[model samples]
Structures are given as C-alpha cells and as structure tokens.
Target chain A: MFQFKYPENFLRALGKPLVVFISRVGELSEFIARALYSCVTPPFYPRLLLKQIINIGFYSLPVVALTTLFAGMVIALQTHAGFSSYGAESAIATVVLISVTRELAPAFAGLMVAGRIGAAMAAEIGTMRVTEQIDALSTLSTDPYKYLVAPRLLAGVIVLPLLVVIGDIIGIFGGYLVAVYQLDFNPANYINATVNELQLIDITTGVIKAAVFGFVIALMGCYNGYKSKGGAQGVGEATTNAVVTSSILILILNYVITGLIFTE
Target chain B: MNQENNKIEVSELYKAFGRKRVLNGVNLSLKKGESLVVIGGSGTGKSVLIKCIQGLIEPDKGSIKIDGFETVGTPRKDCEKYYATMGMLFQGGALFDSLSVWENVAFGLIENQKMPKKQAKEKAIEVLRQVGLGADVADLSPSEISGGMQKRVGLARAIATKPEVIFFDEPTTGLDPIMADVINDLIISSVKKLGAAALTITHDMASARKIADKIAMLYQGKIIWQGTVEEMDKSDNPYVRQFISGSAKGPIKVEI
Candidate 1:
C-alpha cells in the first residue's frame, strides 16, 4: 500500500522557516539585552549621543512635519465629508484633534523616521560590519555596543518624543488650515473645539508611543546592520529589512499602546 | 623554554562555520619581534587564522596563549589586556569614514588611553610622518585619500600606540606593483622601528618574500609548510611549489 506522505512533507516544508523564525527572535532578544546593558554602563560617549540626537531629531524634522501635515489634512477632508451628511460637520475639529494628537502624528512621524533614519543606520553599520571596521574597534579594545549601538539607542529614545510633539502641533495646524479656509468652518470655533476636546492624556499617550517607536526603530536598524553578512547585497537587504520591520513594529505597537491606554 | 621569547603560541586550533571547517588543528608560534607571514590561495583560511589570533573570531577548540595568558574563550573584559597590546591593519584600510585621517590615527589614544586631544593630535601627526604622510593630509577625511595613501594611514593608525604586536591582513592586495613595494618597505621599517612581533596574511608571493622573515603556507586549514624566506624559495613541498610557481596543474585543485 502506497500512502501519501502529507504530514511528513508538510513538516519538512515548515521546518526551515520555523527554525529561522525562532533563531531570529533569539538573536533579536540577545541584541536588545546587550544594547540596553551598554546603555546603563559607563564609558559613555556623550559626543556621539549628541550627534545622533541632532541627526535623528533635528535633521528628521522636515519629513516628519510634511508627513503629519498631509495626514492631518486628509483626515480633515474625510471627516468633513462623513459628518456633513449627519449635520455633525461642526464635530470635525474635535475628531481631527483627537485623532491627530492621539494617533496619526506619532505613528506617521515614527514611520517617516523609520524610513529615513532606520535605513541609513542599517546601511552605515552594515558597511562597517562587512569592512571589518567593527572588528577594528574591537582590536582597539573598544566595545562596539557602547561605541556604536548605545548612543543611537539613547538618542532615539530621547529625541522621538520631542519630534512627536513638534509633529503634533504641525499636524493640528494642518487640520486647522483645511477646516477653516477650505471647509468653510468658523476658525475660532474650530480652534476652541480642538482645544476643548484634547486631554492631557491624549498627548501623553502619543508621546509615550513615540518614545517606544523610536527605540524599536533604532534597535531594529542597529541589530539588522550589525548582524549583516555577505557584502553590499547584504547591506542593501538589511536597510530594506530595517525600514520594513521598524514600520511594521511601529504600527503594531501603536495599536497595542492605544488599546492599553484607552481601554475602559 | 624562555616564556618571554615567545610572543604568541597556538596549539590545536580548530574553527568551523557550520559544516565547512575553516581551521583544523592549526598550530603556530611567533618569537618576540619576529615577522611571520602566512601565504595561501583564496579561501584557504588565512584570514580566519589571523582573526583567531586577534580574538576577533573565537575558535571552536584551541589553546591560544598571548604572552602566556590564555585568550581562547576568555571574557571580553579579560581579553582587553591582550587587545590593548595588539594592532591590526585590515585589508581595505577600514578607516572610520566619519573621522579625519589624524583623528583615525589617534582614536585609540584619545578614546581608550584618554589622552588629551592636543597631545594626541601631535602624536598622530608624528605617526603620520612615520608612515610617509605629511601633516597636510591629517585633516582630510579618509574618503579623500587615495587607496595607497589610505593603506599608509592605516599603517599609521596601527602603529600609533606603539603596540607590541601588529597584524597585517593582505596589506598589499589592492595596490600597484610599485605601491605594493612601497608598502612592504614601510611595513618592514615600521616593524623594525617598533620592534613589534608581526603576523601577516597574504597571497602575494612578492609581498611575502619582501616583508616576511619566516613564511608559513596554509592549505586545507593547516600550515602545510613553513620556513625562512630563503628556505621558502627552495622548498620542495609540492603544495609550496605549486603555489609559488602559480601553476594550474598541481596537487592543489581549483575547486571549480
């Protein structure tokens, strides 16, 4: 009797991916632990930290502003269209303010930074890994985790909250521009509604989410870059993976944090 | 046996990447202030041997003693004492792009030894002069330098701390013949001046003859043959003959 080896083939096909997935998670956890350990340890590089803060926060402002502004504008347009049918168009300001402050600004800004700074970090570190610069640092008795990863991680954690705050203001202003000038809404009334509807908790939640997103973005970039192999192709793949993984992580964490903060 | 005479010794070194074994029971030793160059074809584990010695890559099983201290599997903090005495010149120079040429040379002094920047800068310029570079090149970024100049800068950085041991990884790989000779001469003079024990890995026969006081040929992850430079010229080992003659017809298969 000939029996089809369905379960056997299924297991064979699934085995490699399962192993890869498990190993990836293990590597990521170990990397994060080492990075965090380095963060609190001595031999800190204040100059590198300041450089990363400027690079990640100050240099990234224009992109974050542009992304959040367009996101806020689109939300206003959509909310106006939907609420006008029910004669609740006046509520557009409240909806835009709450959504922008609580979610879009942080999430969009995180994603933008992920695409820009995350990719750059991965490429730079990946190149350093391949060219033996990281090993050279080791031979020089310098720990790469302390010199390379910790500064970026600290900068990410510190700077993203500030960027998110700036992004929130720009986003709300974008909504105001559309609601008052384009949508024929009362400027004073819209501003009043926006201020009235926004709670301190709303902004805090987004700031907290921004901080976590920043850490995740920098971690993924540094981890993937440090672990890269092969050569130039490996660096390219790492950059892509850093951006994609950080973006997805930001979206996933945004939901998780939102659920935790807003749950009744 | 005088323990002070032997700067580094390796016994039964073994390292494998997954199924492919790169280093299999490799053994070697270097005397104080001696220059030993390992010559092999591409993919013959020459780089791996150097990396193992430097503790950049850990061996699967081995005993690596540097000045009588065991380094294999030693904790990184414990390994620092050995690393502090060592310097490496990477294949591609591997200078940090962010820092200028002089800063690259002074990195260890400033970052590790905590030397003042002004003093480190002076020392950097002094070392640069030793490597045949002028102070004018000090402020330029590494990207601004030529390949040969970059290699010289790398040499400057490697010798900046006056380390007791220096590693050269294919130092002459990407240079013109004249440039390669220039680097080889610089390496010889630098090692002689520093009185540093050196371990160099290369496939360039000309470089090996020029810089090596002793030569060891690595094949199949082992030192198949070793001798002084003159003895290397007259070696009868078929592997050595095949490699030195650059012949396609030999015991060493092309693997293709």
Candidate 2:
C-alpha cells in the first residue's frame, strides 16, 4: 500500500527521519488514544496520575473560567450593540447563549488551556528526553509511553470536559451580565430566552468538542516532545510546535466537529 | 588482544547519522565484573559506542551480546527485558524533575516490576545509602540538590536495580576533583558490591584509572587500543598515550 505512493526501495531507504516524522504523528495520536483507553481499563494510577491531572487539568480553572466570562460578556455586548442599532436588540440573549454554548465555550476553553499548559507539557517532557531521563526510564524497564505520555493524555481528555462545562456556565453568565445590566435588556426576559433556546444538544456538542480539543492539545504536546531531537534548540522548537499546533488544530477541528453536530 | 573471556561483547558494530558514520566497524569486549573505560576526544563517538551496547541507539549492523543475547536491532519489547539488568548515569544526571528523589530511584521498581511503593521506597533508600547519601534526601526534588549531590542521587538510581551491567556516560565531567573521586569511589565500590560489569566513557584519566580494570581508546570511530591499567601506561597507540597523558602536543588535532 505504501509503495503505490512512492517507490518501495526509495521509501525504505529514506531512513529514521522519514520514519520519525510519519510515525511521530501516528504514534502521537495513538499515544493519546491509548492513554484514554488505558484510563478506562484496570491497574489505574488514580492518586499518582490524578495529581498530574490536577496539575494539567484543574489548576487551569482560573484561566479558562476567567477567559470565558469576559469572552461571553464581550460577545453579548457586541451582539447587542450591533443588533440594537438595527432595532433587533431583543435578539441579544438568543445570540449570546447560542454563541457562548455552541461556539465560544469549547473553542475558547480548549485554546486557552492549550496555550497555558501545552507548552509546559512539551518542555517538561522534551527536557526529560534531551537529558536522557527517558532513556533512563527505559533502562529502568519503564515504558515512557505508558508512564509519561499516558498520564498527560488521560488527564487532557478527562479534565477538559469538566473545564468546558465550567466555561459554558461562566460564558453564559458573562453574556447574561452584559445583556441584563449593560444592554438594558430585562434580566428575567434574557434568562428566559437563554433557557428556552439552549437545547441539550448544544451543551453536549460543545463539551464533546472540548474533549476532542483537549485530546489534540495533549497529542501535540506529546508528539513534539516525543519526536524532539537535538538539545536546547530542539526542545525550544518542540515547545513552539506544541502550542502552535494545538491552537491551529483546535480552530480547525472546532469547525469540522461543529459542522457535523449542527448541520440540518 | 582480549583475554578470550567476554562479559559485554560487541562485534562489527556500525552506526550513522544521515550519511555521516559515527561508529565505523567498532568491535570491543570486556570481561565480567571488569571496569572498562573508553576514552576519546569530544564527538569522536565514544558515547555512541556505549549507547549501542546499552541499546539506547540501535546499530545499523553488528552484534552486541550481553550474556549471549544479541542486542543489535533487538526488538523494543525484548529490549526492555534486556534493560532491566542494566543501569546508566547520564552525563547530566538526567533525573526526572517531576519526580522526587525517592520516586526517581524507585521509578523502575514501582513502574516496571510493579513492586509496592513502600517496598520500592525502602529499596530506593537502601541504594541511596550505598552511594553515601542519606535517606533524608529522598523527599526533595532533584532540582533542590547540588551538582555533586545530584550526581550521587543519579548513582543511587543507577545501582538501585542492582543491574548486571552499568554504563556511565562522562560520570565525572562536571564535578570538582574531590567530588569526582567521591563518585569514582562510589562507582567502584557499588559495582564491586553488586558484582556488575561496568563500562564508562570519559576524557578524565584520573577517573578512568580509579574505576577501570581495563580501558579502551576510540579515535575516529574505531577502537585503536585497549589494555589493563598497567598496559595503558605503556600503550604504543599514539591516541591512547596522548589521551592518558592529557598532552596537547601530539598527533591529535584539537577542533578549536
């Protein structure tokens, strides 16, 4: 199958760089999915890995929550100001919740968390790698994938859903605050409109998107770190790649997932 | 001129980075419980040779037989089992920053062997004590320790599994002479106590003399000379003599 695209001998002769790059991407995705699979299975490292999860996951609540809140408020004010000039100000609450719940919550939370934490994961693992601790781990008979890559991936999938839920709430509340207080919309009416308009699917879709984004963030981090070669320069390159790839992936995937979820 | 007995046997090994050969037809063997140091100028692939034996870097062609198990291109699964009986002290002490000292030492036992944490911790401390470190250092992060202390901790971690073979990559490069000797002494005693074969790579002749029963000199990707400590002094190889004497006025050209 591989030979159809390139000459068989030519591909085989390409060597470690070729294997490292292609397998790097595949192994990263597999590493993440494997972690998720392992998390759900037995012999769990709950206490140990959870401490890592809290580090990777819960500690970033302040940032995710804060960003969502302001984002929601800004979104509300913008939606209201534009509509009110057109004498359709009443559509503000509907627009705010739809945008916050369906669009902003998962996208913003995943991007924010990825920016803040993905670099740390890549740099931490990348440094371990460059310093040969990963080799040390192997010499000690520990699988670096099972121990290091698994924990990061598992936490990303598990924790981002919760973060997305929080982001959704904070984002809606931010929109509510702006709509009621700043936009001069009736508080009860705005609340009623938001409540009526938000279906179960809206929240579910956004949370699902957040989970995928979380997985991608972690995948990028681990891939960059795992594939990182050289010394300080390589580690720096990996850190940059982790953050940039996670951000770009979050945006691209958000559209793909949203289209699938929301299309009639 | 090996004495016909071999502990770590490497034959016809070859490795390359892109088109540049790092190890070219390298062949070496050391006897059981013997300390062999490979000395060479920087980037002469001294480290690469040790890595091949340790299975850190797979050789493109050759055989590395540790207790008769062929290591060249050994599958990663079998590689783990091969690694369980081996230890390494990375040039920079490579301790995991996220793990506390005790956890780092206990990493193998807990993760690979599935030993209980309590037993692993106890074993980790015991090994730490063997390296002249107190058990009190266990809870601290690796970052909290001084370079010498960190080196000791790395030594502790290396010997924790009581491995059958150990590789020390520039084991004393960054330490002061006194600390270097301290590490050298610890390496000797611990290897003796564990009855493990030890291979070290370094430019420090003092360290090599203190730790090695035999030494080899690698130059331009080949083993130019190897001998007992007594023979090392009388070695006719220009590279080995220049290396052991630390002479700048020799056939060696410094890359400056």
Q: Using lDDT as the measure, which candidate wins?
A: 1
Name the 10 consecutive residues with the lowest summed lDDT in model 2 chain B. Answer: B1-10
True contacts preserved, each candidate? 0.81, 0.88
Q: Clashing pairs in model 1?
A: none
User: How do the residues A170-259 of candidate 2 rate in per-residue lDDT, one tens digit apiece?
Assistant: 998999888878767788988888888878988898889988988888878877887798999999999999999999999999999988
Candidate 1, residue A194: lDDT: 88
> TM-scores of the models, in the given order?
0.96, 0.90
Model 1 over residues A1-264: C-alpha lDDT tens digits? Answer: 333478766656677888788889999999999999999999999999999999999999999999999888989999999989999998888888888888999999999999999999999999999988999898888999999999999999999999999988998899899998899888899989888888899789989999999999999999999999999999999999999999999999999999998897
lDDT (C-alpha) at residue A77 in model 2: 86
> Where does candidate 2 chain A have its weakest 10-residue lDDT segment?
A1-10
Tens digit of per-residue lDDT, candidate 1, span B196-221: 99999999999999989899999999
